[model samples]
Target: MNLTWRSSSILPRTSRFYQKSFRVVSTESRKESAQQEQEVTHDQQRDPVLSEEKKARAPFLKNLFLGRFDKDVLGFPELNKARQKNFNAAIAPALKSLMDAVDPRRTDAEGTVPDSVLKELKNQRILGGTVSEDYGGLGLNAMEQCLVAEFTGSDASVAGIVNASNNMVIQVLFPNSISAVNKYGSAEIKQKYLPRLASGQLTAAWCLTEETGGSDTTMLNARAAKTLDGKFFDVTGKKIWVINAEKADLFLVFVRIQDKDELHNPCDITSAILVEKSEAVALSPCPSAGLRGAGIQNITFNKAHVPVEHLLGDTLDGNEIAFETLANFRCASAAQVAATMRGLLTKTIRHCIDRMAFGQTVADFDMVREHLGKLAVWTYAVESMAYLTAGMTDSGEYPDTQMECAATKVFSSEKMWSCLSECLVLLGSKSCSPKEGYEQYLRDSYCHHHHGGANDILRLYIGLKGLEYAGKEMQALVKVMRHPYDNPSIYMKKNFRGLWESIRFNKDNIKLKMHLYGHIHPTLKHISLQPEAEILERLVLRFPVVIEHVLIEHGAYIPQRQMLLRRMADCIIYLHALTAVLARASRSYCIGLRHANVE
Candidate 1:
């Protein structure tokens, strides 16, 4: 093999370029060119690190893989009584009046809410739902913002627009950036945008998703390089499909900000720059099938000059911000789905009582009752998942619930899809008509499947996450097989850990005949769906065994089997969502909040 070496100074780092081993053939022509250079093909490249956070599941989530669906192992995130005041005084009331004044059809057609209504929304502090009071925000926690998010649920576009601007930027992203800057950036950077962001004066959009690589933040075309003076960065690149783009005053653009001063560097270094939408930034609205009110657009930054103060956190903090925001976005998406499903329930019940069929009210029909019951269960489950997640975050039990959040989003969205379908079928042609709000709900509901990470992609996360711990164990076993004589202690756990755990678990299982009875929260003990719900619990318990077996059988090749992973993802979502419903029901029963109960 011929080798050539170049100085690190002159050599440029290329993206995803791998050197292939040369092959030799017996033919004279092949043998002659055996030492020929391998041409580098500029094919479609992928950044393995993009969305890398989704590659592995958190250890807490690994318990689910072990057949411990009882989330109490995760510190069993519950409602904290301390947050009652904030919920009662600000969040709940605001949600009650949220988006109530906006006409869905008119907003859908006109692509904007009434100024009067937006003013009312702002005045009520619904717009500042996620912001802290110090910066003129409502100072609500994740749970509080979730309540407000649920209020926006009736309309997907409303939720997308509001959540994108307020929740995505200020609620989740801004706070993280501020903390990072305070810890890493200068004091001036910390104080720069909080007030502007907290108050409704300035709106920011997340510019992580690009057309070339959708939701792939690693392959960013936009980049920033240090200016010769070392005071500013010359940022350039186009951002597409940014939520609230046209209306945004500030943009949180994700790109790789080059740092030449560092001695040693890690891979996957990206930065978030707070770019104001000035003349340097050109924006054009991107028309969509739904979310018209969101004002998503394609934005171009023609060498936008960003000062050091505008850089978010330290270098390489961009991925953290992106993932944090994405996690928050997933939680908000579930809340939105809950609200949407509830809205459908409200319209359905009202219509059922009013409309007549066979000279009898639709409510009197058995099929209607069945459909409504299913819808009610689904809506309850979604609301449960959303609130439980928000409460989990607020309680600070699981600060990083990447798997749980993604699971909630996928579950809620799929449920919402089924919900709207049933709603449309139940509503008949009236809903099929252009004027009905159901049409709008159906359109907006499509966003759930595609945005906040697509369900197909997210499902792979669930399947893999559930198998993460097991795969690690498998990795240990493989290592031991490769070096059997090296260390008995190292391979001991790999060799017999499962057997011992299974024995211990089986003993515990035998000791406790009824798993659901003891695990059920006291608050939820009163609600008796035990016969059916318990069946689900037991069946779901078996998932870990299946997952363990799959991981053992496939070993490291499991990632390539995304089709199987997606199916496993579907199962895990339903199981996790079911448990979330139980958790939410227990919380509601404890708190006496009837707003989120099934029966």
Candidate 2:
């Protein structure tokens, strides 16, 4: 008998020997072919990428402004660009020189910023940088002021001086007393004060927190009563923890104007101005654990005379202004924290790569890698959110930005502290010495964490906003549900159409499976199998199920139909990733295809 084993048709033979030999050959070839097909199929599955071509690419500016660019936005890119250019070209260079001149690398016995360095910082006009040029100052934007904070934060002393200077500039720029600007001068206030501030010629500090009063401005009791001349207020109070007071040319003191009962609002507070070097004043500097070079002070106003013109805003408006300024300044402080964290991480990563442990670099350790990965993820999330919020505020899309701002501030500042602490751990105690740059970061970060509104307070603010949004969401949801029957016909038609589309979309589901398989086959030859592809396939298969669950769970917060569709989209993308990774891995193994540098 004769047998043809390789034919497409099933072979049958009359002779037992031929039949047996044919069966053995056919079985072996079939197994080999199946294995080859599996290789091909897996490679195809992982071959396709998330196709960068389909990504929505646009400038962050356009994304931010959307359609109402010309009419609605208040922030000027031109203005910011100009200010940034000025900072980079003139201000940053000068400040860098000043920092270098002060020897940023030098640390005293206790990490104190040297007195000479502090003197130079005070002399540099750090206070005048944010005031507009017309206001007897350099007229920098809020963004530039933030950059100065970041620059100074590289060294604690400079950061302290810059903090004092920037806050003072903020106080002068936003006051309701532009008319009083020309009057309070020694011609010197404009000349010596303005030019000095503009040129980093003079620095200043703010005194707001009392021994008893913390975040509550209304609780302040420092008294400012009108003087005999009726043009001045005699301010008498002890203001504590005033930064840069040692060399500050001015002090912004918050005082109570309680006698004017009508001025008592929720935020009713008043500014009692005082000068540091004035003949009648007594300033006692405090020794603080962090910001040792910052020169915190206890100032006794002692009936010190502050010109009535120096009083900022309406007496009742002080609380409002204080809250606003603090909110605005919180963004800057958050930025500084982010920068310091970034720097610390950068330095630590470099150290890890270079330092040997267990006969290999620390970076090679799996545990260390995990920590670095977490640090990286945190940094990315915080940095992106903070920059986005800052851009929003600058562009004036921030009418209700308080919630977002507070959220970003609290999250990023707190994240930065955690990241820094981790970094210090990675560096080890010996490497974390003041001389080594680790301990100072830990110390300075404490101040950064507390500089803005406390995390706890911002959390409360966030909770309030969340509840308000949740209420609105629930009302809209209720309205939709109650009126569901009113549009029965329309709803029927829409549902019918959606069902038709879903049916049509899923009709070629096997083709989806085939296409996915094909895409992954080529990819499998080049790399090791990643679980991402498997997870994606499973997610896609479970897409409809996920939609149902989400509808049941989150229908109140998200519109039912839209949420279903979004889940479906997410599933498709995830499936796409799965197919791509599987294909790539198969292709890598089979044909030695080039593996991507995926990280």
- Tens digit per residue, CA lDDT, model 2, 4-68: 11112222221221122112235658677456546543312211111111222222221111111
Pull out the clashing pairs in model 1.
none
| lDDT (Cα, tens digit) per residue for candidate 1, span 290-390 | 78777778999988888877777777677777766777778877877887787778888998999988999999999999999999888878876776666
Q: Which candidate has the top score in TM-score? A: 1
Instruction: Give candidate 2 regions above 4 Å deviation.
Output: 1-82, 100-125, 168-196, 199-201, 259-280, 397-401, 431-437, 465-599
What overall lDDT goes with each candidate model? 0.64, 0.52
Model 1 residue 566 CA deviation in Å: 1.6
Model 1, global lDDT: 0.64
